[model samples]
Target: MSTLQSQSKIEEANKELVRSFTRTVFVDHRPDRAVEFFDPKGKWHGGNFGTVEGAQNIAGLLTAVVGGLPDIRATEQDIIVKDDTVVVRLVVEGTHKGNLLGFPATNRRVRWDAIDMYKIKNGKIMDDWASEDGVKILADIGAYTPPWMKSGN
Candidate 1:
């Protein structure tokens, strides 16, 4: 195969790897399976949540999310892959069944968008940077009152 063909093949494989990982961990609600996709020292850069190091810590974060939204489902809106990187735009929907971000259970359904970029190495995720629509999520769950919704305005 030519160099260009080999590069394209690698990119496709990386994209598939990310898709599989997302299916196993988020869509399947199996945070315990994170170790299968993440590198031993994988790092997750979660905006506002700080940087989480190690696959176990990343899994812990996922566990918390699943705990709060037991029925959470992530639907991929877009996916872009190049070489060792994969970026996914996702629409996440769930019910607030348990505490999340220090907010008590609201039992409200919420939908939000998120974009995550992952760096793959040796078929494992070595780093991930995630950005989510926190304000919308909080508003949907009644955790945040918008300025326009405030009384005496």
Candidate 2:
């Protein structure tokens, strides 16, 4: 297969993985069932609290985090496929129904824009780097006070 074709296949697989996680895993809170979406030795980076390596660790984190969300949606804004990699721009919308990161449930709808870059090898996702608008989510829930908001913009 040509390089472009290979890239496209990887991108498609990555998209399916994302869809599976959003619909089946996140919505159902089935973290233990997410082995299909990640490599056994995969790593997740840039999650603010810490980096998680290995499927077990990631699964544990997901279980804890998803326990509180009554509803969650991950919407892809764009996807770019390159050789052995797929980059996705996404918006994560969720409602907090339980405590998270030391904050109690406000039942607030949180919307965070995120960018996720996935590395694929042998048609499976090997690793990922993600960055999300954590500040915006916190500010929206009044948990954060931006320094620049002194003038109340």
Candidate 3:
């Protein structure tokens, strides 16, 4: 295939991969497919410390955390694709219906803006870095109590 054609195909695959990740992660809450998009031993950086290796590890971690949110949605705001990577900027909206990160459900609406960069290898994702504005969501849900909020000396 010509260089231009190859680039186009890569771009399309990157976009689809990003979309699939969004669907599985935020919409369907299915984590079994994470390795299908990530390297089996890939290391994820930015805003998180967990190292996920293999699809089973990724699936188990996600499944454990996903049950907290009964309603969740992610909307892609923009996507930029290069020769071997795709960057997706999105906003996630959800309502807490169960405990998460030790915080009980407050039944409040929350939103977070995030950007994820996925590196593709052989038309499959190899690794990813994600940055998210999680503090905003915590503040929106009244779960983040600032020291300034405390009264009395």
Candidate 4:
């Protein structure tokens, strides 16, 4: 195979892998199940809480989120792949059934937008930057209290 053909093959493989990861890990109830798809030094950056490295740490985070949104589903709205980079936009839908961020379960169904960018290396995802609208989620679950509604404010 030629060099261009090899690169094209790699990109195709990466695209397929990302789609599988989305459905099996992000969409399904078990994000950690895609452990093999991540590099040993893989890092998932959540912006505020810092980077989460290692499969175990990522799994813990996923598990915690699932604790609150027991029926979470990450429905991929768009996926773009190029070379070693993959970008995905997801509509995360879930139901509040357990405490989250110190708020009691409200049994509310929520749909939130999430975008994730991944750096693929050696056929594994070595880095990820993820962003989600959190304040909106809290409000959807009736967890956010306005300053005017607070006792001291």
- In the predicted model 3, the residue pairs found to clash are none
Better of 3 and 4 by TM-score: 4
Query: Where does candidate 3 stray beyond 4 Å?
Result: 48-53, 146-153
List, residue by residue over 51-83, the lDDT tens digit for candidate 4: 899866776777777888888888788888888
How would you encode candidate 3's per-residue C-alpha lDDT over 30-148 as one tens digit per residue? 76666666666665654644456655676666565565666778899999998888899999888877776567888888788989898877756677777867677667677885666
Where's the lowest-lDDT run of ten residues in candidate 3? 43-52
Best candidate, lDDT: 1
Looking at model 3, how many pairs of residues clash? 0
Tens-place lDDT per residue, model 1, 45-106, is 98887899999988988888888999999999999998899999999999999989888899
RMSD per candidate (Å) reads 1.5, 2.5, 3.0, 3.3
Instruction: Give candidate 3's error at residue 81 in angstroms.
Output: 0.3
Clashes of each: 0, 0, 0, 0
Q: Top model by TM-score, which number?
A: 1
Q: Tell me the TM-score of model 2.
A: 0.82
- The better-scoring model by lDDT among 1 and 3 is 1
